[model samples]
Target: MGGTNCPTCGTQLMDGGKIAGRRDPGAQDVSICRGCAEILVLTRSAQGLTLRPTSATEYLELPEDAQSLLRVAHLLVRRQQRLVRAPRQLH
Candidate 1:
């Protein structure tokens, strides 16, 4: 399940990546890598779900519907603006 790579550190995600804690599970959907703290968005297709890197600029580029979701997410939880350093792999 951990096949996706972190855009920031290139660390492979585990368990299809960890869910970014959200108050509104319906609107606030996000995935993150524990190794690099990189945020991502899942794009679903006929094949399956694919995770894409998410940045502040990218968020602005999102469609209005997506923007609305983010807005709702903001009211629910204050997202971290700073980059979280990648933790060392135990291996």
Candidate 2:
């Protein structure tokens, strides 16, 4: 994984390196758009790997555990985003 842009928000996501206990992303792997927090799926083409917005039905078809994990991950991303956007306080 090198880099890809979020299809929804066009946020450039860069993969620094492979995480522990995680395999490289392949076709149909689900991803979250860090910019808009939208659910995306990986699609491979002659050009390279890219993201596409996940359909409602496609999301519903995931296992319950997977759905739960996605929800939590989404929350975490949103929380981090909010923290970054929050104004700093001076002592």
Candidate 3:
């Protein structure tokens, strides 16, 4: 497996020129881009896995619970990014 770039933000979703994450991702697996919080899916090709934005229809097909989880995850990623950009000052 090789590093895949997020199609939406073009952020490199790998580390040290290799895939880096909790586990190896497979084709059709949904992922949220850290750069833009765009929901995406992995696509496999002769080269390697690539990220593509998840379509609205594809998202709707997911179970309600799964969809909710993805939304929450996206929000959390955005929140973390905001925190990193602007840390709160001590009172």
Candidate 4:
């Protein structure tokens, strides 16, 4: 509902409806129209939600919700890495 056109295909998405999926924890899930299903990852960064295609050179900008999800994923990944590196303590 943020952008007027679909980020992947530039098609006009419906004004009001459930436009994306939320079940996936790290990734921002979007329902693409019949044509633009090639995109795979929608990541939210400091800049914004960046829609990246698995095989393409270009990226599509995402809305706020997607952006937030990407930030969460980024934080989670960092936390996991920190835990992995931290020295374990035994008593």
Candidate 5:
């Protein structure tokens, strides 16, 4: 999956607009682009998943596919967090 070039730096992105070597399978926070170093944060809850920039001051945007991936990743992290916070039964 190829990605579009960054508008600011014109860096070509690969794999759904994700930078190489910056992907994290177990990442619960934002992922930064290797070219422009833009932070991509995904948030999820019972409602659904949402992709957005981490900081308001910074104006960075990720491709649509990357945003979708972030949403899924965020959901996974939320699920894991719920499991971790669940109460254990004492036998």
Candidate 6:
């Protein structure tokens, strides 16, 4: 997986970079496209996963209201990571 390339940007993930909307941790990951700087979703089925640029392109054009939800989710996740890094001191 370390040598895997981003489905969206086609950039090689040197150190096993994880992508958003990914169900699995690293074994099966979705990555943000460096070329477009947007999250890339892969089509999964019996054939296996494949990048559908049309879908990703459409998602990027979603209305602000729909896109805002993603922003908040990312913000919350970031906040959680920060909290995990900094332990609260008990008085």
lDDT of each: 0.50, 0.64, 0.67, 0.41, 0.42, 0.45
TM-scores, one per candidate:
0.40, 0.70, 0.70, 0.32, 0.31, 0.35
Worst 10 residues of 2 by lDDT: 82-91
Best by TM-score: 2
Q: Stretches of candidate 3 above 4 Å error?
A: 1-3, 16-22, 83-91
Candidate 6 per-residue lDDT over residues 1-91, each given as its tens digit: 3223555446553334333445444333334444334344444555555553435445567666655664455345446544343321211
Write model 2 residue lDDT over 1-91, tens digit each, in one string: 3437776566776546421112477655777766666777776667767677777788888888877777777777777777455321111
Clashes of 6: 0
Which window of ten consecutive residues has the lowest lDDT sum in model 4? 82-91
Q: Could you give candidate 1's per-residue lDDT for residues 37-77 as a string of tens digits?
A: 54566555555445666767766676778666656544333
Cα lDDT tens digits, model 5, 1-91, are 1223333334454355333334432333455434444344434445433334355332225456865664555455445545444322211
Best by lDDT: 3
Question: Which candidate do you rate higher for TM-score, 3 or 5?
Answer: 3
Give the alpha carbon lDDT tens digit for every residue of 29-50 in model 3: 7767777677777766677777
The C-alpha RMSD of each candidate to the native structure, in angstroms, is: 9.1, 8.1, 7.6, 14.8, 15.4, 11.8
Candidate 1 global Cα RMSD: 9.1
Ten consecutive residues with minimal summed lDDT in candidate 3? 82-91
Counted clashes in each candidate structure: 0, 0, 0, 0, 0, 0
**TM-score winner, 5 or 6:** 6
lDDT head-to-head 1 vs 3, winner: 3
The all-Cα superposition gives candidate 3 an RMSD in Å to the true structure of 7.6
Cα displacement (Å) at residue 31, model 1: 1.6
